[model samples]
Structures are given as C-alpha cells and as structure tokens.
Target chain A: MDVKTRKITGQVIFVLLALYLDGLMKWAFLNNMNTGEVMLIPQLMLMVLVMLSMRISDRRQLITYGIVFGLIYDSYYFGMIGLYTVLLPLAMVGVDHYKFLFVKANMGYEISIYFLALTFMQSGIYILERLLQQTKVDTMDFITFTLGPTLLWNMIVFFILYIPLANLSDWLVKYRRDK
Target chain B: MQKFFSNKKLIILMLIIIVTFGLLAVSVNIKDKKSTPPVIQQVGNDTVSIVGGIFAYPTNAVKNASSEFSDLYNTYTENRRLKSKIGELAQNQAKLKVVQEENKKLKDELKLNATLTDYTFVNASVLSRSPSSWQSYLTINRGQTSGLKKNMPVMSGKGLIGRIIEVNKISSKVELISTDNELNDKFASEIQSDNKNVTGIVSKYDSDSGDLVMENVTSTKDVKKGQKVITSGLGGLTPRGLYIGKVSAIKKDNYGMTNSVYITPAAELRNFTVVTVIKSSVSGEE
Candidate 1:
C-alpha cells in the first residue's frame, strides 16, 4: 500500500478504537446500574472525531467519515437510525467550517470548539429522540440528569487526554513526502 | 424554473432535511412495529458486534475480577449469614426436586407439553451497553441462531433485569427495566400477599429513588412491605413466577387516585458478565 493509503487506514483505525472505547468506558466505568440519578455518557468517539476533523482538510472526507461512522454508531449502539447518522456529520462540518478562523489550534480553542460540538450533537440527539417519542424525559430533567453530567465528564476526559490524542491525530493526518 | 434550481447549496440543504426526517420516521416506525430491521442493518450490527466481542471480553474480565475483589471484603460476614440458610436451602432443594419430578409426571399424564410457568434459558455474555440515556440497551453475544426472540425476559444471577428489544443474526440488544421509555418498560407483575395475590403492572421506573413503580394494583390493603413480586404471566410471552423484585413502598399518585407500589428489583442491574434469556414455552400473540 502507498503511504497516503496507509495514513488513511491508520486514521480509520484510530477512530474505530475510540468508537469501541466509548462502549467499553460506558460498560466498565460509567455504568449507572441502580445507583445514581446522574447519567454520564462517555463520548470518546466524538472526542476523537473532533480531533480528526480539525486536522483533516477535505470537506468531502469529513462528511463521509461522519456519515459512515454515524451509521455504524446508530446501528450498533442506538439501534435507531438517523440520530447520530445525521448529527455527527453536521457537527463535523460545523467544526470544519469555523475551525479556519483560528491561526493555530491550541488546548483552549480546541477545547471550546469540542465543547460546542458536544453540546450541539447531544442536544440534537435529545430533540430528535424526544420528538420521535423514544424518550419521555422532560427538558429540565434532561438538562439536569443527562446533559450536564455527560458534558462535564467528557470534557474532563478530553482535557486530560488532549495532548496524546492531538499528537496521534496529527501524525495520522500529516502528509509524508517520501511516498 | 431552471434559474430557480440553480442554487446548489439550497438544494443540498433541502435534501439533507428531507432525508433526515425520512430516515428518523422510518426507523422509529420499524422499531414500533417489532419487525426485523432491514437486511443491511442486521448484517452491519452483527459484524460490528462480532468485532466488539473481542474488546468486550477483556473488559468484562477486568470488571469481574474487580467485583470479585470487592466481594472478598464482605465474605466473612456473608459466610456467617449464609451458614444459617444452608440447612434450610438443602431441605428446600430436596423438596423442590421431588415436586419438580411429580409435576413433570402430572404434566405428561395431562398431555401438557408446556404451560405459562415453563421456560428455557439461553446464556449470553455482555458485549456492550449503549451510551444513550433513554435507550438503556445492553448488547449480548447470543442472537437469532440461539433461538432468541424479541421481548424475551433476561436475567442476571439474581433476578429479572430486562427484555430483548432487538435481535440480529449473532447479537441482540436487551432493554433494561429501568429504561424510561413508556411503551416498552411495563411488566405484568403480582405481589404475593397473605393467602392471595395482588396483581399489578410494573410500569414506571423512578430514577431518582431507584425504585420500579407497579401500578394498577387490585388492593393495597393486603400488600405489605417486603412482599415478593413476580411476573403473573397474564401477558403470555413472559413465564409466570419470574421474580421481579420486593415491594419497597406504596404511595398514592397525584390527587390520591390510584396506588403505586414501589419495588426494589432483586437484580443488581450491574456487575454480572453473563445474562440468561428466558424463552417461554407457550408462545403468545405478537
């Protein structure tokens, strides 16, 4: 395989790793199971996707990744189509659109951008699920129990893992001339 | 007309909106209908779950080890408490075996192959739990090939935990009893009261208090705290006498209309790696 193809494969593997981690972390650590009212959903895949979108420059590529991963995520995890399948790509494109305004990516900018993206994606999911009558959780209860804790937990995770994750995504997206 | 269609961006945006609603509506309809999802979706889920098992097994191993460590801390006191019950348990086991054999003979004589009380179980390991808030699904390794079907009650070691919501070729999703979804959470349950039974529907889950609300109860007068609740088999797919929980508290709804009995489910709802899916002998109407 050529270097370009190899890099793309590596990027896909990285994203997939993060995707599995989302399920694993929820299964292992954040398992609520008859205990707490606060539901914290770990969005590790979104964190990885945001990092990749910030690095990869192609708009078409971003949308494609979004739709493909979104489909898998919906089919396997949610068991319902169109929630992540639509929202994930929209979030990726949103990040890609405004990301150029920054001269250079840093912890603060990336963190804030991720924060907005997470908020947007989560709220979009909540609204869609609510409208579809899949969930009856009221807005206040949703904001309090589900949204707030999830954001805080995922943001703290993003903050801690930002350096290693950012470097890895950079390595995956960077062009090598030797190939 | 040609000039009106010239805006490519607007057309794309319109298409996206149409597609989004279309997909959501169709999927939601499919879910409500209880039909198998499209072929591509089933294949995709099975493939994903097959790969997911590799990751889930190791994580579940670690989880089991850690929980065992915690169990070790309380073993001494637990052992002392369990020693007293051992004698009673042995007697009960003997009696149960005799009764089971007699019942089987009676059933054969009566030409009854299966009844509401009869069921078989399939064991499956936990693959992954959905990260969504309201869905509350746990993917398991067993699926259609295992004779599993949707709406089968699943249990951990302790008691009933949930029911199968979706099934693929090799993987299925279990929707927990604690799910906030109104349509899928209700269980036809009954409480063993003095000399009689108090039947009700275990409908709502109170997340804040971590109690299951059993409504439509016949009488709260006979009901008491600590009474055992189990499936009544009124709904047919679920077998009778599947342990649900113990009656924790009884309260009146708003305006003091109907009584709702709060139950503390026996299943820990966590910690267990393997789950048993109970397939009832008598198939009911879908």
Candidate 2:
C-alpha cells in the first residue's frame, strides 16, 4: 500500500528476475542450447549485480535464496548438491563477517568481500575436491581456467546489481520519512 | 568449584548430542538413494543421447529483461513473414516440428551408433572455468551414470580437456591434458601422439604450452610439426582418433629419434559447452 513496501517489492522482483536470468545463462552456456547466444551481460556479472542489490534481513532468508538458486540449477542438466550446502552458507558467513568492517570503510570494500566470499565458496570446494582425490583435475591447469574469472564474474554481477538497489534503498528511505 | 562441575556436565551433554546427531546424519545419508554415485563415469559415455531423454525437451523456464528490447523487432517483419503467408506458414511450421523431432531421433541414433564405435562420447556440460591462473578444473554435469570411467578421455572441439578421473552420481572431474601436479604416477607415463599415432609414455605435461612429452621411439621417426597426435590403438585402453593436439613445434635430439614437441588443442580450454568422451570399443581390436 505504501511506497516503501512497493520499493521493497520491486527490489525483490529485480533480484529474482536477475537470478532467473543467471539460471537461463547457465542453461544456455553450459547446456549449449540453440537459444541465440547474445548476452548483454554475462551471468556472473549479473550474479554480482543481483548480490549487490540484495539486502536480506536475516540468515534464514539468505539460506532460502541460496537453496532456491541451487535447486533451479539441479533440476536442469546438473545435480551438484555439495555446492549448495557448502557454498551458500559460506557466502553468507563471509558477508556477515566482513560487512561490519567494510560498511564503515567504503562500498568497495563491501563489494570486494562479497566477491572474495563467492569466489572462495565456489573455487574452494573445487580445490577441496581436487586435493582430496575427489576430482581428476590436473591441479594447475584447473586453477588457471576455473577460478579467476568466476570470482571476477561474481564480483561484476554484484557491482551491476548495486546501482538500481541503491536507488531503491533511497526511495525506501524517502517513503519511511514521508510516512 | 560449582562452576567447574556445571562446565563438565555441559561438555558431556554437548558430546552426547554431537554423537547422537552425527549418527543420525550418517544413517540418513546412507539411506538416501540419490547419494550413491552413478556408474559409467568411463564406459557409458555412449549413452549421452539416450540419457539426455528428459533434458532435451524445450523449456521457456525464464524470460529476461532483454526480451522487451527484442520484442518490438519480433512483432513486425518476423511475424509478418509467417502471418501473411498462411499456407506456407502452416506447411513450414509442420515441417519445422517434424524436423525437430527428427533431429532428436538422430541424436538418439548417435547414442546407439556410439556403442558401436570405440570412441564413446560423454556429452557433459562445463560447470566452471575461471581466468584466474591458479584455479584449474572443470566440473561436468555428467558423472558416473554416463558410463564415464576414471581415465576416460574428455575433449572439447579443440582437443583433450582431460580424463574423467573422479566421478560422482551426477558430476565428474576432468583432468585436462595439460595438468600439473598429478597425484598418481602409474597412469602418468603414457602419451599417445595425436599426429603420428605413435604411443609413448609421458615425459610430463609441459605447463608452459600445455602439451605432453611423448617418449619411446627409436632414432628415426619423423615426428614433425602440424602432424596430428592421437591415442595409439596399440595400448588399446583409449579409443583411437581422439585429437591430443596439433604438433606446433619440435626439437630433434639429433642422436636419437625423439623430439620435444609442442601441441595445441582446437578448443579454448577455459570455455566450452559440450565435449565428447572417448572410450575403447567393447568389440575390441579392429
């Protein structure tokens, strides 16, 4: 009914929509479908954008979003449950751990922390899998190809997502004041 | 003294809870059917098309913001072509659906035809590859159930991504042809030339260019550049005709019949959608 609520709803819709796009990109890129591969922004970039837009209230919601993201992946051609359970909470933990220091320092710090956490959450599991003889990767080559850009991509996604979310946050503040 | 007693009691309580929950968790994990690893991480790559039965269906699961930008173009000439020519439209649409069905049928045919060939391709998706120099590994969507075996070869359009060295029910890890720090030495000593069909044990995966070091030739084989290197049918473990790489450069020993050769793949290792898995044919020794 109020502008603040409407703003919050819009933000949620944007994040969800971005997530859906990332899921589609995963399908398009990974599955090699015939879906005309013209990406305005790559999925990882979009992911970072969405993450930047995100300002969840509590840990439970963060976990819920993570599960939803993971399940969307699983239902498709992939089924990596280990990634979701391990990576999602770790992302949240890293974010929470760093949020306090970064928030005071600058948005850049906050963003970097998000990037590092997501990167670690993803590639860390990969590293573990390879090290424990759980994977068949030729350790160095795997490092060269799989870790770096994935980290940067997530960071980019967060960066892009932050812009619109900032405007929405401003609006929410305005509405709260007016009320 | 009283506080110490309470702390001791608390520790005992925590330990009991941990053990109880740990046992429960283990039992639950054991009970779940999905938790088990799928077989065929190596041998069943021939079944990708068969196994792709459900996954190949078309889906409009997620629409994106960019659609609004493109919707205007679709509404005009795109629709007019199909709309004005109704008779042609009907025929073409019917034909198009038929063609699609046919295409899927052909894919199934490939799957069937696959088993007949020594080269069994396990079509798996690239899960992750980053530009970071250190993070080298690709997670594939297909795992054990796909007939992927440990040491089963994987390649993109360019050439060898690696072998399916580790496998779970739904995913597999490929050890790319140019991997460093191999944990196992036994399988490490073999490199089948993509060019000459000469079989030699590996000197090592040269990281500088990401090629293999092939050994065991006399002082007379003409191992030259642009020559194709592939698995030798002699070893009979991996199917032949798999591209190891194009021989980029070579340095002759002068006294012996060996050269330090550089080979490059056809596919960019960091990015690719699909890849084939090469397996030795069940029929054996042609």
Candidate 3:
C-alpha cells in the first residue's frame, strides 16, 4: 500500500513483462527451427534483472527476484529445473556484489555488465546441459553458433532498449530514496 | 581449518554449486523417468501457462496474420495449381468416405473396436517456444485436463511436428522434431515406395540441412526421393498412417555399412500457432 511497496511491485511487473517477452519474442520472430544453425536466445529478462539489480541496493530482494523468477522460468520454459533457477540468482548476486565498483549506472556500464551476465548464464546452462547429456553440441560449435549469435543479438537489443529500460528501472528504484 | 570453513563467501559459493548440480540432476532424472513432474511443479507450470495465454493469444494472432499475408503473395499460383486438382480431390474424397463407411461396417462385423489408424485429436494453441537450443519445446494450452498424455504425437496444420514430453494440469510441452537431443525424439516411420514400405526410425535431426535423418532402416533399396513417409506405428505410443514427410535422400553412413534416409519434414516447424495432439483409440503397452 505504501510508495515503497508500490515501487517494488512496479519492478516485479517490469521483470515479469521481460520474462514473458523472452519467450514471445522467440516464438514470434527468432524461431529459426528449420534452416539456421546459428541460434539467438533472447535474454530480455536477464537484461531487465541486471538493470534492476544495478539500481536496487537490497541484496535480499535481488536474490529473491532471481530465485522466484528463475524457478518460474525453468519450470515453464525449460521443463527442467536448476538451469535458470540457480544461474539467475547467482548472476544477480554477482552483479549486486560488484555493483559498488561503478559509481553511477550508465549505458556503457550496464551494457557491459549485461554482456558478462549473459555469457555466464548461457555458458553455465551449456555446461550443465552438456554434462546431463541433454545436448551434444561441442564447445567450439556452441561458442561459434549459439553463444556468438545470441550475444550479438542480445547486445543489439540492449542498445535499442537501453534508454527506456534503464530509465524505467532507475525510476522504479530511485523513488524510495526520494521519500 | 575453522577459519577457512568460516569464510562466508566461500561457504556460500560451495553451497551454490552443490545445490545447482543437485537440482539439475534430480530434475533431469525426474523428467526422463517420471510420467508427470511433481505436483507442485505441475501446479506452478499450469498457473504460469494460464497467465501466459493472455500474451500468447495476441502474438499468435500477429503470427497468423503475417503468415496469411505471405500466403496471399502466392495465392494466385497456388490457386491455379490447386484448381487442376480440385476435381480429382473431390472424387477421392467421395471414394474415401464410402470406403471409410464400408471399413467401419466390416470392423463392426468383426467386433474390432479400434485400430492403429483410429485416432481422435485435441486442438491446442501454442503458448510459447523455449528459447533454449537443446530442449526446443513448445508449451501448448491443453494438458491432462484435456485428455492429453505424454508421448502423444502432435501435428500442426500440415503434418507431424513432435510429441508431448511433459503434461501439467492445463498445459503441456511438445518436444519439436528438430531438436538434436539423442533421447526422446525418435518416431517409427515407414517410406511408401512403389514395391514395399521400408520401415525406419526417424531419429536425428540434421541442423545444417534442416532435414530429419531416419536411421536403422530395414532396407533402403526400394526407397527413392519424393516418396511419402508416414508413421508405421510399429512401436511406441503414436498411431499408424500419420504423415511425417517425404523421402528427401538416402545416404550411406560414414562407414558405409548401413543407409540413412533423410526426410524433408512436412510441417513448416514455424508460423503455426495451433497444434493438434492425436489420441489413439487403441492404447499401446505402457
């Protein structure tokens, strides 16, 4: 009911929207089922989470968002648990831990952070899936086809969406300090 | 020893790794071995799917509209070609209806309840496709509540696409045929050639060429390019006579010991929103 709760609710909604968009964007456009070997996985949810974690100083809240959304993501999309469930929270916590290094969040700092997080989350998933025998793609092919394209595409998307997303997350997190 | 163990960050990192592998291993085992996921996971998936429908509907609409616009581009040529077949198609349909009636009567006389070809279907709109590479699954709206079960062969408008891998309370995941997963994507298929039908397992997906590779073929001698391939219904949950694709090419394996038949899948594997899950009237061994 208070301004703080409402702001937190807005942040959650923002992340939720990103979560759903990740799947929808893939379904609607990035679905290259037949011809292409290069795959581009939209990580808008990770982007949003990274942006929010940069601004939202509360480590507990960041981890909570990570675990809850990660669970939902794993259960809903991947059908197996732990890929997103573990990596999402860990990536957020990693962001939160090193966030003090940057004095102010800007396009450059946020984009680089997202790049690192995306690489970590994706490589973590690749390793886990490979170990489980869920996928047989070798490390070279994975880096060349899946990781490279996904990073390039997501970075471009981050560039195009950086202004709106960064502003929105900034507003969502800054209101508590204003009060 | 106590100081090293007491380092809080180190302890947390170890805990994270342990939990990560633990959850991943257990869930992967459950996915492979269990018919259904745990009850809590089912409830969580169903709830998320219900909310996802709101977003999915609009996206599906846009997809359909765009595909339709593309269809419009080729409507003229398609219509001209299809017009020539209209008369033959009508005759075939009438003959098919009569034959179906006579076949039903014969089955009734023989006291046969259901055959491999006897199947009913439930239609469900696709909610979303997993963005992951290895587990390329599409979450559909219908699930156990809609008389759906695991391993049901799902079809898009044209032909066979994939099979249901996971079913929740009201949503299910269909593993696409294009997935490179070594397990859980095989379909028993047969190519209809001039002399005899050659049976094979539609196994691996060739991502480079975008063709499905059918391995362990009985004999590829009679197989030729452009012949229709259908589910032979020899084993597994799928019923017989479901159209899979056409025989694209037959090539010998690397060692040249056996042959593998490549098929051009009939389903577009894209642009379609709704999928039909076929429920065979005759149940197979569980």
Candidate 4:
C-alpha cells in the first residue's frame, strides 16, 4: 500500500474505532446512570489520539478522517446527539489551518492546545447546553476532580506518544514522496 | 527544516481549513432550540426536544437501519418483537406523565421543608470523611465557584451525615454528626421522643448491646425495654421521630446524673454518594 492510500484506509479504521469505544461504553452509561448524572466526562483520550494520528498524513486527510470518525463517535455515545460530528471536524480544521503557522507548537504549545481543545469542546458545549436550559452544566468540583485527571492523563500520553509518532510520520511522508 | 512547507496542495488545504473555521465560528452562534427544523431560522427549532433528550431518534434509526439490508440480512425477527415492546413503552410513558404531576403535589403538601434554603446547592461527590469522633467531618466535590459557602450543610438520604463547616467550589469539608459526642446526646432525646411510649434524656449508647439506661426514671414512668429509640429532634437539625435505635435497658443511675445509657445510631455509614442540597425553596419555581 502506498503511504497516501494506506493513510486513507487508516482514517476509515479510525471511524470504526471511535464507534466501538464511544458506543458500547455509552450504552453502559445510559442504562445504568440516572438523568442529569454525567457518566463520561469528555476527556482528551480520543481527541489526542486523532490529532496525533495526523502526524502520519496531511491536512485534507486529517479532517477527512476526523469527520468520518467523529460522525460515528457522536452517533454512538453522546447525549448531545450531533456534537462530536460538529466538534471533531472543527478540531481537524483548526489543526489543518494552524499546524504550519504554529509549526508543531513545541511540546508545551502542543500539550496546551490539546488540553485547551478538550476542555473547551467538553465544557464549552456543556455551558452552552446549560444556558440553553437543555442539560444541567456542573462546574463545581468537576473542573478539578474530573477535568484535572483527564488533562493530566492526556499530557502523559502525549509525552510518551509524540516523538515516536512524529518520527514515524516524517519517515512515511519522506518514503511516500520518494516512491 | 520544514520541507513540507513547499507543498502547494498543503497550502491550499490550509487556506480552505482557515476559511471554513471562520465561517463555522460565526455559524456556531448556538441558541437553545428544542425540536426545531434545520432550515435557517427553521433549522434551530424543529428538533430541539428530540435532540435534547435521550437520543431517541438515533435508537429508532438503529432499529430501522438494522432491518434494512444491503446484502446480508442484518436485523432478525427479534427486531419486530422489540419494536412492539418499544411501542408499548411509549404508550406507558404518556400515562406516567400524569402520575408524576400528582406525586409532586404530595411532596409539597408533606411540607418536607429543611432549614438551609437560601443557597445554591451544587451536587458533588463525597471524597472522604473523618475517622474519629461522632462529630466527624466529610469532604464534598464542589468548592468556591460552586457557591458552596463556608458552614454549608452536607446532606444525603433522609437526614444522613451533615453539617458543613468548610467549603470551596472544587472541594468542601463537612462536620458529620457522628464525629461529635455533643450532638449525639441532643439527637438521642429527639430519637426517643418520636416513638413515644418511652422516656429518656438525649443520650448516646451502644446499639449492639442489650442494655440502655434511662435518666430521671420514675418506676411510675414505666419506661420498658425493647421500646424504640428515635431522634428527639431537640437538636433542631433533623425533625423528631426519626428512628435512632431500640432501647434495651432500664437500669437506674447511682448519682442520679443518669446511667451509662446505650443507644444505637440509625445509619451504617459506609458507601453513600449523591445527596440532596436542602436549600430553601424559592416561591415560584416548584
């Protein structure tokens, strides 16, 4: 498989992955938890995973994967209904637009964006939903108890992940151009 | 250093992303729309309710989609069975709406009012509690931003461990009634009053032991064993008549100060989360 085409296929796999991970656990959350109770606080888990995967490819492709992947993710797990589809595509577009001007963003910038992105995506929609009188937005201990761990965990994963993935992506991009 | 910058296709793609994000930023002026349609002003209002609640449309779509087969038969006859069950459930839901309205009225009439009513009670998790003293403290998950003022009461169940002494939005500490012996004595008198048919001072005694002593005992008062010991409600926290424990003794005191009265606590403090914030109800939005 040529690198470009293989990367395309990987995006499709990403969609399926988002579906399985978000869907089954969502089923559990829905069946067991009560109304107004938050089961899965939005985390950086999938967001970082998708963003990191982009190192292996290009901007157009990143969104192509993210949108396809996001549609499935939103469909399965969230009560917001269409949010993931909306948010994931936007995140991809954000990265594609700024990835170069920002230029890898260093380690701190990357992690900060990653953290800010997840927090804004999760809490932004939640605050909006709460204001609209849809779902109640809980900002109490959630900022610390819940948001802190998710960010910390994602940062740890990113540190472990970025260098290897960046190298791999560089290798693949070079190899594809040579071929 | 940046070899990828020379790629024209990448530059064009970045331009497209930048423009699209700008458009979306403007378009994302999301107002709350319930059951609204998706065309201009029409789009925001058509399906908000359906969108708000339990993604019912999606599940329905799943059922219909499963029955639809491009090649192999995906959904089985069991789908039909489940579909009918879903139909029955929908009918039942309409009936439930009426019952819920009726129940709300009853709660109001019961006058189940608590003392702390003038504050916003943020629902938070119980992180930890003190290990010693009946006047023990608990920690909650909310703090400063949550409007959890200091000395706010922590509560759960029908009057579980409460009495908030410290608070922040992200975390708060609570002084549980179990951690202090002073409140326990006051609570005992209240517990004993609820059941009536028995007499005793507000006191603390062992629950498991069979003997509970009574102060100011007149053999004529006829305080008998095995009588129920409940909250006397004199402490002004929980109301009178709440069950605390059963009386197991009728022994007299030597100094007339009272005997070593043994009384059991009502609740077994272990794994409880999700408490009600008993703030005073504002008059219009019941």
Each candidate: what lDDT?
A: 0.91, 0.49, 0.93, 0.44
DockQ for candidate 1, C-alpha atoms = 0.81
**Alpha-carbon error at B9 in model 3, in Å?**
2.6
Off by over 4 Å in 1: B1-4
Question: Sort by TM-score, best first: what order?
Answer: 3, 1, 2, 4
Instruction: Arrange candidates by lDDT, descending.
Output: 3, 1, 2, 4
Cα lDDT tens digits for candidate 1, B1-286: 8976998988989998899899999887887686577788999999999999999989999999999999999999999999999999999999999999999999999999998999999999999989888888999999889999888899999999999989998899999998877788779999999879999999989887888999999999999999999999988579999999899999999989999999999999988999999999999987
For candidate 2, the share of real interface contacts preserved is 0.00
Shift of residue B123 alpha carbon in model 2, Å: 6.2
- The per-residue C-alpha lDDT of model 4 at residue B191 equals 24
> lDDT score, residue B16, model 1?
86
TM-score (all chains, Cα) for each model: 0.98, 0.49, 0.98, 0.35
- Candidate with better lDDT, 3 vs 4: 3
Q: Write the per-residue lDDT of candidate 3 for residues B54-101, one digit (tens) a residue.
A: 999999999999999999999999999999999999999999999999
Off by over 4 Å in 2: A1-54, A63-84, A97-109, A115-157, A165-179, B1-151, B155-161, B165-175, B178-197, B202-207, B215-222, B234-237, B250-260, B266-274, B283-286
List ranges where model 3 is wrong by over 4 Å.
A176-179
Q: Which ten residues in a row have the lowest lDDT in candidate 1 chain A?
A: A28-37
- The weakest ten consecutive residues by lDDT in model 2 chain B span B56-65
The per-prediction CA RMSD against the true structure, in angstroms, equals 1.2, 12.8, 1.1, 18.9
Please tell me what DockQ candidate 3 reaches. 0.91
iRMSD for each candidate structure, in the order shown? 1.0, 11.3, 0.7, 17.3
* Most DockQ-accurate candidate: 3
